[model samples]
Target: MILERIIPTVLSVRRILRADPALVKAYGGDPEKHTSLGLVTCDQDDAMYVALDEATKHAQVDVIFARSFYAGAAHASGRLSGEILGVIGATEPEAIENGLDALLRCLEHDACFYDADGKRTVTVFPHVIASLGEYLSKEAGLAPGTPMAYLVAPPIEATIGLDAALKAAEVRAVRVQPPPTETNFACAWLTGDLDACEAAAVAYAAAVVDVAAQPRR
Candidate 1:
């Protein structure tokens, strides 16, 4: 029987940013500070996060092979074709066409997996495609084309160490005072992962609730 793929919707604490207080006071009264932002998982599995963390830790990474149509056409010169032509010139055209098609697929796959920010961005992996298209349009001096879609394998390693560190640390959530408007983002300092992290949040909230419930000691 074929095993079903398991994907988890992850909520990471990394995306959160701090907010300003003076502005809050100006508008009303006390500014509630927030340190971290919760990131909703784009997919079902934490494999992508684990994989990205692994790739970041390891050096000498393996090169994933991808063949672009343009790259394949450039490489398919008479010299390279000559060897195959000698064996089967009568059917050379068909073989060359097939090779070109395969090359296009390879290029498309590579384009999909191309990522710059590693784990931080891997959670929002699909966004990379749009980001790439925008980048390529500017670099290539051409109008942006509709974005292409592709799948990426999560990193081959797990991030057990990072997980352990987050669990062990006592992080305070704080809002940042604004220097720039863009700097004014909301954030929190909770652990990663949906279940464990959320459970921790619930536990913390329960403790707070319990404290409030107690009469003045």
Candidate 2:
């Protein structure tokens, strides 16, 4: 049997709505928004709870997905990108991919979260071609390749990595972890095979959770 694990990264609705007043009016609410909005004022943990609640409703469905709550205050008010990405990248690559794939699948349907103004604010997943092209140019110092090449390269690399990992392992496993905030973690999972990739992903998820559960120094 094929094992798969998923972890999702999500944004807070209250924070988003607060940032843009236009969102409030879009959801059929009064144009004259109050300084104190009740429903959307919760913190990242609250946002995660909302996202998880929504995810649970769709759990019985065949589609795959997961959700992780992120502190909008940290991202917006403070520059926590480095720290956030570090936490996320600490997880295994395979785990990240599975979670992302499931998230993408969920996104395909209308299950994505919307702001009070009804604007879709979810952007946890990255586009393959654009992401890969940017990576090659920026990191690898390679010129942009053909669209076909860009599309094929990531999966091919994934397949090779999966094959290698599977050969090293005695048994198959499913892995999952919270999505990373940095481009590095996201790109690593994208650069491998879809089938053999799950084990590494499961391993990564397990590691990430273990680390997160550990007491801070």
Candidate 3:
């Protein structure tokens, strides 16, 4: 329960998923040649954490991101407490399966899934695209065949920098990551003509510092 009460880690992999779907897809391809991703859900938050720890110790795997105890109206109604959801990554498909087995074998009803060998049982939380029109809504014709410029800063300044960057210049593609890296740093990209990208990058960097350095209201 205590583990569930803590806020979840930021899903930094989402940024990677959005930027280069093909690249990630390749990385998560055949379990025999490439790495795979896994997801595990548990009703007991503490048990999940312990199991994950044991699994990692016994198997070669990495934890992408995890969360426990997401509170909602159902919790307020006393219908539920909270649950643990975690993502694991491994270099081989067998490693993923072994890791999950080591962790979940003790549990009676373990809900575990993996992406390997033409089997995709789990949905990576940050990689789903439900609507088609939303993707087409962005007009790439605004600036074609242009280079992109990136501005990196603290996550706390994502809003300030992103707003200023878009307003400063015309851009074709833009991606903002409030928590891009493991260090919790943020970054934004502006794609357009070289001149426009440079201008937007400058505005974005300045706005981030100016906004984040200010005192709270």
Question: In terms of lDDT, which candidate is strongest?
Answer: 3
Candidate 3's C-alpha runs over 4 A off are 1-145
lDDT accuracy of residue 83 in candidate 2: 15
TM-score to native of every candidate shown: 0.17, 0.24, 0.33
Q: lDDT by residue for model 2 over 1-217, one digit each (tens)?
A: 0111113233322112132345434433343432122221112322222222232232321111112225333344333221111111102234333333333344343222112111222111111222223223333343333111111111223333334444533433222122232211222322333332344433433333332233242
C-alpha lDDT (0 to 100) for residue 60 of candidate 2: 21
lDDT of 3 by residue, 1-217 (tens): 1101122221121111122334435444333323466666544443354455546655676555455554321233233323555555666767777777766653333212112112221111111111111111132222323355545444556566667878988864456557644323454555766677767766765665455345263
How far out, in Å, is residue 216 in model 3? 2.7
**Ranking by TM-score, best first?**
3, 2, 1
Evaluated at residue 101, the lDDT of candidate 1 is 35
Ranked by lDDT from best down, the candidates are: 3, 2, 1
Q: Report the candidate with higher TM-score, 1 versus 3.
A: 3
Which prediction has the highest TM-score against the true structure? Answer: 3
Candidate 1 lDDT, 27-93, residue by residue in tens: 3323452221112221222122222212212221111111112221124343322101100001123
True-vs-predicted CA distance for residue 157, candidate 3, Å: 1.4
